[model samples]
Target: MAVKGHGMEVKDHGMEVKGHGMEVKGHDMEVKGHGLEEKGHGLEEKGHGMAVKGHGMAVKGHGMEVKGHGMEVKGHGMEVKGHDMEVKGHGLEAKGHGMAVNGHDMEVKGHGMEVKGNGMAVKGHDMEVKGHGMEVNGHGMEVKGHDMEVKGHDMVVKGHGMAIQCHGMEVKGHGMEIKGHGMKVKGHDMEVKGHDMKVKGHGMKVKGHDMELKGQWYGGKRSWYGGTMSWYGGKRSRYGGIVFLNW
Candidate 1:
């Protein structure tokens, strides 16, 4: 004998098995009771409480609440939140455990964010903290026609583990600025400045219209004021090139 009731409450009388396929196989049963509250021993099963065997599809509410374990199989796109979230097989995979927020803009305002892989790449704007910043494994930050400022200890810009090479302008240390083509400096308390600067094998070279050094000038040839020619601190005749004097 089969008895079914809609919008009914059967309480305290003892054993209650709600749904079809209880005593008989190949039969469909559905219990749609709205706002039904079961307090003690809410749901239990001897084997597999909710099992969908042989190509069956089970979908819960739009905002379903599962208190315990949740599993998905052979699905294209599956999303899970809270605690253990696992995925098997590779090919365009995004898996996160211990609070993973996946969106267009994911903002994490907590502690510790880790990315474990051989090489991690970032295609957008990557900004670091004020005091500490780093790049590893033959990869450094590359900015095209933009300014980068690092205000901390030991600023190193190296190519093949050697300072700087092939640059328009390269500055180092405190108060020393460089601004032209082909320059190099490797000494304590050194200053090198140029226009259209390049720091290479040689040294400092100012390849521009005007070049000045410590109130002295060099355009065509080397000469001092009052018709005096000094080469390597040796005086000679300085009546050929133009010399400017400050009175």
Candidate 2:
């Protein structure tokens, strides 16, 4: 699953796990924080806001929103849109941070294009992602800071927005290929196309299959890991290929 900056923790998943599902922590998640922490499968935060969708989906945060069957939400201004959706946030809709969807197929337009599907495409500020397989594109792209390391293989990054095409996922960064259990991360923005990818970061998008996305005006020195690079705060590690991605 895709995991954004200080996004969802494994436990924070609202949906109950059943089979092969890796029990992704940050599927369809959004977060903004300074310091980060992950406990069990939950991301307890002290940031702007955090959201997680699951079985009996419910979320809490400033302008937080969750949508699904039997989805009931509670917050100062929260919203959950679906057939059997319920909410308690009085100003949720007014804030425009709220979300709406039917049967999981989502396509939000205008304000901030936040679309959801097997081939998810989002055009907005955070560019968040959710589910097992998805993609996100935004303006805050890439991880650029001191101590950021990406080793081994081809780490080529050249483009504006990060995109992931199904089957043959072609990234714009240095003509990289993450097809077979490979992970591609350029600074903060990344595109994971393989079945099993492992990259780490601090909060924003969450797509299944071990992909993480984090967003911020300024990149922070944090450490976290999955299969390849782990995310940390001013932390360092040794890998294979060392490439530089500047956005």
| lDDT of model 1, residue 139 | 16
Candidate 1 residue spans exceeding 4 A from truth: 1-130, 135-139, 142-166, 170-175, 182-188, 193-247
State model 2's lDDT. Answer: 0.24
Compose the digit string of candidate 2's lDDT tens values, residues 1-247.
1111212111221211121111113333322222112233334333332323221112232222223221122321122332211222111111112121322212221111111111112111222223221121222111222111121221212242234322222344322234433334444434343443322333223244222233321233332222223221122322222422222
Task: Work out how many backbone clashes candidate 1 has.
Answer: 11
The per-prediction tally of clashing pairs is 11, 56
Model 1, 153: alpha-carbon shift in Å? 22
- Evaluate model 1: give its TM-score: 0.15
Clashes of 2: 56
After best superposition, candidate 2 residue 93: deviation in angstroms? 16
Each model's TM-score, in the order given? 0.15, 0.23
Tell me the spans in candidate 2 whose CA falls farther than 4 Å from its real position: 1-45, 48-64, 67-114, 118-124, 128-247
Per-residue lDDT for 123-211 in model 1, tens only?
11221111112211111222111112221211223221112223322234311232233233332112344432211321222223111
Q: Candidate 1: lDDT over CA atoms?
A: 0.20
